[model samples]
Each structure stands twice: as C-alpha cells, then as structure tokens.
Target: MSILVRGMHGLGDNLHQRAVIRQLMARDEVFLESSWVAPYHDLVAAGLKILRKATPLRTQSKNADREASLFHRGPLPPRAQEVRITYTPDLVRARGSVLAAMCWATATDYAAADFRMAVPAEWLQQAKLLFNAWQPRKPVLVYRPLVDRTEWGGCRNRNPDHGAYAALFDAIRDDFFVVSIADLVPGQEWIVSRQIRADVELHKGELDFETLAGLFKLSAGVFASPGFAVILAQAVGTPVACVFGGYENSSSFAGGARFSPTLGIDPINPCQCFSHSHACQKSIDIPAASARLRAFFAEAARHWPGCA
Candidate 1:
C-alpha cells in the first residue's frame, strides 16, 4: 500500500508536507496528496497520483485504522501506504527531543522538503496566465503591501504609506498595478487607496500563482514583501525591490530585502520597529521604504537588460 500524507497548510506547512513525502517515497512507493488541505488543492491537482478527498463519491477508501488513516474515496489511481502528519512537534522535531525519532521512528530518517522553496509547476502556469490576460503597454509594478494587526507610532497602514514606493513606475498608473495578498477586510481596503494613481490589484482568492507569474512577466520591477509571494516573484525572473518585515526570517526568506523602518532599519526618529511591543508592522515607514524601492526600480531599469 502506498502512503498519502496530508497537512498542506500555508507555505511553511506545505514544505513540511513535501519533505515528509520525499522521505517516504525514497524508501517505498508513496504518493503525496494535499486536497483535504486548503490553499494547496491546485498544487495537488497539478501533480500525479494525488487523489482528492473533496468529492465523497470521487475518493477510494480501504479498511484500515480509520482513526489513523486519511483516505480519499475518489478514483484511486494506484494505492500507496497512507498516513497523515501535521505541522506538529511530532513531525518536525519542534522540541529537539529525540522526539523526531520517537514520533517518526529513528530507523531511517527522511528529511522534510523545504516547501517555501518548492514552487509547484501549476503556480508557474498560473503566473503565465496572469501576464497574458493583463496586457499592458507600460512597465508593471508588483508590490506586497504590509498588513498589521494594529497601528502604532509612525506605523501608518493607509494608501499614502503603502504607496510610498509608487515612484518606481515613472508616474504611469495605467502601466502598473500593485498586488496585495494580505487578507483585507472591507473597511481596510482603503489602506492602499492612494495607489489609485497606479492600478493596484489586491489578490484575494481570485488571483492564483499563474496570475502572479503573469504580473511578474509584465512588470518593470517588483516591490516585494519578506513573504512567500516575494520569493516566487524573484524566482520568476523579475527584478525586485524587497523589504523585510521584522526578523531573520524577513531577510533570509526572499533572498534578502532591505529591512523596513518597522524593522529598525529606518532612519526615522525613535525607530518604531525597535519598540518592545513588537510594533514593527505598524512602525514600517512607508516613505522610507518607498524611496528605497524606487531606487531599486531605477537600477533595474538601467541594468535589467532582458527584463524590461
């Protein structure tokens, strides 16, 4: 029997899933499936031997420890040993206990896959579609707007602040649209209201990886976050002016970005990100970030020979 491991959560979780699958597949024929996992359904579809657990009539199940097993009753392409591992300590050695062994077994260990770095082929295709659908004459501007849980001193979250980096587009609003992936509330949509000068796209569920890739292909430059999208954008062959959020994960994640004022890198007074309350999100200085971003764009234009 082949194995089907679940728990494909956010970028980090997906990495765990992939890592575990890689380990299992090395020994026996294992199939990695993540349909029961939200946000990663498309990814699972793009891969082979992955059966969806969504359609009850479409899945296939066998008599196994029902509690320990997670099976798809759908069209079973070819059955593999099935198991489920979450983003729990038991799976990844969270506590540094002999735990990783106690839980997964110490006999022969399989290193987990680094999900953030693993871009599914489907997402690349999605990016291609986005570029093709939105045909623009002017160079594109791709951005990742910061979303904070709360506001604090100099921690502006509105359009004026977020668009501080807008100077990169050469004042061509029709040519560029910034992308925001932060889950925005109806009331919070206006945070980036000022980007009206430039076409700004807030990518909720509507825009997938293909759309993002398309945008990257069409862009003159990117204003990236310290997040997953930024990593993807850079990898898609786009010149990016990125800014880190608050920690080492901020810099190391997207191949490194200029740290934001909210990250103690800003020259502004009292450095909002330096506060003890973890106000970095709120303290990100829009103007400071924007200035650096604009410079990066200009440099890209001057040097990014094929990218323009």
Candidate 2:
C-alpha cells in the first residue's frame, strides 16, 4: 500500500522534503498531497504521484507559535502512514538537512543519496526556445532577489538594499546577461534600483513553476537570496551563489544547513533570529555578499567556459 504524505507550502521547503519522500518511496509506495505541487512536476515525472490541493493564504498574527505549529502540522490523510515533521527550535538547533531531521524525528533511517530532480526533455526544448527568443548577447545568470511582501515571512533584514545589488549588477553586466525574477508587488516596483533593472532582463510576471525550473537547469549559474530559486538551482546541478540574510541557522537546524557545502555563499556570521522573523536585528553585509557572488561567477566561468 502507498503511504500518503503532505508536502510543504514553499517551493524550497517542498524540494528539501523530496529527499525524505525518496527515502520513504524506497520502502513503500509514496503518494504526496499538496496544493503547491507544480514546482515538483519533475518529481512526478520521476515516479512520485501527487494529489493537488490549494494551500491557504498565510496571515500575520501575534501568536507566532500558533502560526508556526499550524504549518508544521500539515494535513494527514486517513489510513496513510503520517510522518509528523515539526519545525521546532530543537530541530532548528540540530543544524542538519530537513530531510535528515524529518527522518530522525520519525525514527526512520536517513538515505544519503544526493538530491535529485527530473526535467522532461520537452521542458529543455522550451527553455532553449525561450533563451533564443531573448537573444541575450552573453551567457545568462538568473537572479532572484527577496521581494516578497513584509507580511509574507520573508525576513526584511535579509533583503539587500537596491544600491548594493545594483553595484553587483554593474560589476558583472559586461560579462553576463543578468535576469531578475524578483516577485514585485504593485507600488513596490522601485525596490530594484534603476541601475540594476536597466542592466537586467526582467522576467516580470509570476513564472510557471516548471518554466522556472527549466530556466534554472539551462542557466550558466544562479545568484539569489536563500529561497525557492536557490534551492531549485542547486537541485538541477547549476552553480548557485546565495546571500543569506540573518535568517539562516545552519548550525542549529538541518533545513538551515542543507545548502551548506554546496556552491554558494552562506552568511558570514551565525544568525540568531528565527527564519521567518520580521524583527531580526542582523543583516547581511551587502558588499561582502556581492564579492562572494563575483567569486562564484568567476569559478562558474572557469568550469563552464562556454559561458565565459
């Protein structure tokens, strides 16, 4: 019998959960139920079945603990083996991959397989067509800035100021066609400075999740704050440079540490704040983050000479 599972709400979280799902599938048939499963179509292609359901919109509340608990305790289907994965302080303190943490929490054995996803041949063709249509003069580097609303649990402190990123764009625009996929709400369009925006090819609308994944697969590299794009890029084996705002605590939580040892820049200092807090007192050093991205691009260029 197949074990039914509920997936995480965010793309990155869900991607991390794939590792756990793979481990489960090895022992029993796995059926994943999630409203936000478009990003995991690749997983479906790889043999996992999904039951689509719409996720409820999250709202800000004074009771942070209650809100957090609600997300951690996702819906459990009757008759299916339920894996109770909670994002507790203890789990965060473990400083391991969320997949491993989940396994440990449930007393299940951890599988050491590298994270993997399947991109359909058709998706590759689509990406190629899209790339050619854009006619970029240089190799493409996708950048996803932290542009979600303040109420959305994206820590404001982690978001780089416009000037810092614009400087980074100026530093690299001569060598690569930079693409910005920051999700901008109306009236907040200027958050990305004019200097950076001028240099970047803006992907304005919300991208179909599959298309975003396809673009990540085809890019020379990716640069972004820790979010869906960063995780997706890493999953597809694309080199990634990530800027961690004061939210990541890889030393404590497995999810926080999952991106470590990958081709990316982690926060220079340990972040003591909660991952979703709006009250984080610490912020990333923009100039230093920019430098790390520059180095990442340089290394990627060496390995992928075609992009140089």
Candidate 3:
C-alpha cells in the first residue's frame, strides 16, 4: 500500500518533516500531498512524487475539524494510506530526538542517518554561474536577515536589531564575502548593511528553493536567524551560526547544537515577551557574538581547505 503524508505550514517545518517522510519512503511507496509543494519541488524531481492533483488547502482554518479535513481532500488511488505527523517544540523536548518525534507521529521506524536534501544538478550549475559572476575574492558566507514585521507566527521578536546585524556584517566582511539572502520588504532596506564594500552583496529578488539549496552547498558556512535557511544549510552539510533574539531555546531545534557551534545570544534566560510580542528587553552582545562566529569559521576553515 502506498502512503500519503500531510504537509506542514512553513518552509522550515516542511524541511524538518522530510526526516520522517524519507524513512517512510524507504519502507513503503510514499507521496506528499500539500499546498506547500513549490518549495520542495527539487525533492520531487529527485524522485519524491507529490500529489499535484489534490485540491490546495489554506495553511490554517478557523475550524479545527476543517483544518484536519484538508489533508483528507482529493481522491486517492486504490490501497493508498494516509499518515499524519506533527512536529512542535513540546514534542521535540519530550522525545529528546527530532527525528524520533517525527517518526513516532507517523508510526515509522527511525534510522540513524544524516538528514538529506536533493540539490538538482541544474541548480548546482546555476549556483556556480551566479557565484562566478560575483567574482568573490574570499570564502563566501551566506546569511539571512530577519524582517522587522510579525506576520509568520509571532517571530518578529526573534529578529535581531538592524544595528546588531550591521555590526556583524562589518566585523566579518574583511575575511569572508558576506551575502544576505533575505528578500527585504519595501522601506525595510535598513535591516542589513548599506556600506559600499566589495566583499558585501545583497541578493535582491526572491530565490527559488533549488537555487537556495545550491547556494548553501557552495558556501563556507551560513550565519542566519532562526528560520528555514538555517535548516537548509544543515541539509546541505554546511555549518551554521544562528542569531536569535530571545525566544527560542538553542537545544530545542534539531540541528541547533549539531550544526551550530555559536549562537548570537544566550537562550538560558529568555525575555518574558518572547514569541508573543516585539518589545524584548534582552540585550545581545554583538561584538562577542561576532568573535564567536569568527572562531567558528576558523574551525570550519581547517576542514575546508579552500576557505583557509
């Protein structure tokens, strides 16, 4: 019997869910049915077929029953089984294993293996062309600056201040070609560095998932806020240095400890207003964070001979 997996909402959530789906694919014929298919088309091309004929559903609904019903929509072929899996901070904390929690929810057996993401060969070629066009002189470090708005699940408070990001960019530009991958909103351009430097480049426009995966694969390391990019970098075997405001615990996420050696701020005493509002009173030591990040890169450089 073939299995159908319900999709999660955000890019990061969907990426994390792949750990479970990959295992299911190993045991049974599996297909993903979700409205969020565009971000993961690279996987589809790599052999994970998606149910495109299924009716698209909104990410959330007012009625809880309706929300669950979306997964049941569209016709399934004979002998197709549906599986539902949910990953949350509570589940991660309780299970002490992100992969296990994802597998437990879907009733799949977990295997100890590295998380895998498919970067299409074409996309890798495109990334090579793009990087060559930029003519970077030093090792490139990719980054994503958090937007100032609070649209995606009250995450605005987790975004570092523009000044703090500016300090970080300034600190690292001498040794690494720093690139910001965030698609900034109009009038919100100041969230990243404005200084004219040869080593700094702001990637304008929206980049598709394949291109992003390719970029991550080519980078020396990634420095990003808590978001999809961090997970993407990890999936491509690139080390990450995460910058957080005060909301998330560093250990709560799957790759936070394994891939990220340094965090921008301490998560031990999180601000009371975390994950709810943007009025955070916690202070981030930008200079110290920058030094730690440099140290991380130095360690990574030893393994990546070209980066040295």
Candidate 4:
C-alpha cells in the first residue's frame, strides 16, 4: 500500500507532522512535498519519497474537506489514502497540541510522536564556523524577530510587542550574546522589516534550515513568538523563552498540549489576553516578560553550567 500525506502550510506545520509522517512511512510508501523536505533530511535519508509541484494546503481556519480534496488528481489507488492534519475550532477550544491532532488524524499512536530530529554533522560544522567568526565571550541566544509570513499565509496577532523584546534583550545583553535571525528571502516584503535590537544581526535570511537547527543546538536558548523557532529549539534540546500572545493559549504549543508545571520556561502569556486581533499581543507586560526570560535563562545556566 502507498499513502500520499500532504504536508501543506508553513515550515512549523510540516515539522509537527513529521512524526505522524514517519509512522505512515513505516506502514506504507509515503510521499511529501519537495519544498518541505529540507527539514526532513533524516526521513529522506531513511527513504521518504518527494512529490514536486504539488499544491501545499493550509487547514487552519479553512474547510478541511475542501482542503483535503485538493491533494487528489484522481481517485486514490486501491488500498491507498491521502492524509492531512486539519485544524478545527474545537481543537483550540480543547487545547490540543498540533502533534496530538496530527496523531488523531492519522490513527497513529500519540505517545510515539517525537519532535526531535537528527542534525547532520556538516550542518553543525557550518554553525561552528559562523560561531568562531563572531568571537563572542558570552553564550549565544538566537532571536527570531518575525513570525513567518509567506505569499499565502501569516498571523500578525501572534506577534508580541517589539519594543518589549528590545528591552528584554538589553536587560540580558551583559550575560548573553544576542543574535537575531530572520527568514526574509529575496522578495518577502510582506514579512516587514527586522526591527529587534541585538549584538549581531544574522537577520539577512542566510541561515538555511539544517544550519539553523545546528545553530539551535549550539545556542543557550531562543527568544521568539510561539512558532517554528520554539519547536526547533525543543527539537535540538535547547531551551526557549517563548513570548506568547494573541488568541492562542500557551498550552496549545507547550508540553503535551497542556502547561507542564515542571517546565519552568513555558510560553509566557503574561497578560492572559485572547482575541482575534493584535491587541492581545500588544497587551503583554514587558516587565513581567523580561522577568520570566531572565529567570528562564538562569535556570538554563544550571543545566548547561557553561552555556547560558
């Protein structure tokens, strides 16, 4: 049997779907989008087939049935099926993590879904080269200044106050070498300008996925809105100080789709505000957020001893 699993939407969405995709690959021949293959280097090396020129799908805030139908050129072959992780309002209401939702959608064991990936040695070598060139005395903390915005998708409501982020970075600058990174490519004007203050601006959008993953492994932590950076940091075993806001709850992205009382650095939605607009993001308390970040890094230092 063969299954063509559509990993549509952003890098983050595809990443969340990786574990489920891995399960499917074990049971049947699996096909995935070509563009999405970069983050799946291990899976590709393990033999996941690539499908080129396929229409990528986004199920969030859209009709799932219609979106799933887009994957079909004709009727699927006998004993085969197409799969996509669909977002429902109820999923948010129930506070389900994307990984669990994907598992349910695919009939895969939720307990088996792991977000971690194997970083290639070459990628780490490149990151080491960049790190040595910087010559920083302090530990590295990568900052993601922008939430992803592509020609077809984005969510401004998730963006926290930039000024607050700047203040927080300044507060911690003495102890950490803050390096801000952005995904801005040749023509992504919709992503807006990178505006965060940091010791170095690696925001030229030069870092590729593998290199970025490797960098995350080398860094002390990541500071960003709840997005791919948070996921990647977790995958690489690096701590993250997530500046969460907007309509979503912190649990939607954190430990097992719920707040982990044990994890000190859960996403900080200080204001506890929720709305469809950017006002919720704007409501975050800068001082509280900064305090949380500082505490989080202090805890990270205890774990790494030499890094944070």
Per-prediction CA RMSD (Å) = 9.6, 6.6, 6.0, 6.3
Considering every candidate listed, which one attains the maximal lDDT?
Answer: 4
Each candidate structure's TM-score, on Cα atoms with residue i matched to residue i, is 0.50, 0.77, 0.76, 0.79
Report clash pairs, candidate 2.
35-53, 92-252, 92-253, 93-252, 94-252, 95-252, 95-253, 96-254
* Of 2 and 4, the candidate ranking higher by lDDT: 4
Candidate 3 segments whose C-alpha is farther than 4 A from its true place: 35-47, 52-75, 96-100, 109-113, 185-203, 256-268, 271-274, 278-281, 285-288, 305-308
TM-score of 2: 0.77
Where does candidate 2 stray beyond 4 Å? 42-47, 58-78, 106-113, 160-170, 187-195, 198-200, 249-268, 275-291, 305-308
Q: For candidate 2, lDDT tens digit of each residue in 8-110? A: 6666767767767767777876777554554555565566666553544331122122223322243444688765444655565563555566667655565
* CA lDDT of every candidate: 0.41, 0.58, 0.61, 0.63
Which candidate number maximizes TM-score? 4
Q: What's the true lDDT of residue 194 in model 1? A: 35
Worst 10 residues of 1 by lDDT: 58-67
Off by more than 4 A, model 4? 53-79, 147-154, 185-187, 190-196, 255-281, 305-308
**Tens-digit lDDT track for model 4 on 21-50?**
888888787777534555677887777765
Q: Could you arrange the candidates by TM-score from highest to lowest?
A: 4, 2, 3, 1
lDDT by residue for model 3 (1-308), tens:
68877766556767777767777777777778554554455555555656533332222221123224323344556868888777665666666545556766777665553355667788888778778877777778886755554345544566655566557656665777777775545543324334435454555545655677787777787877767777777676777776666555444355434543444444335443335554664456766777877778877655553421
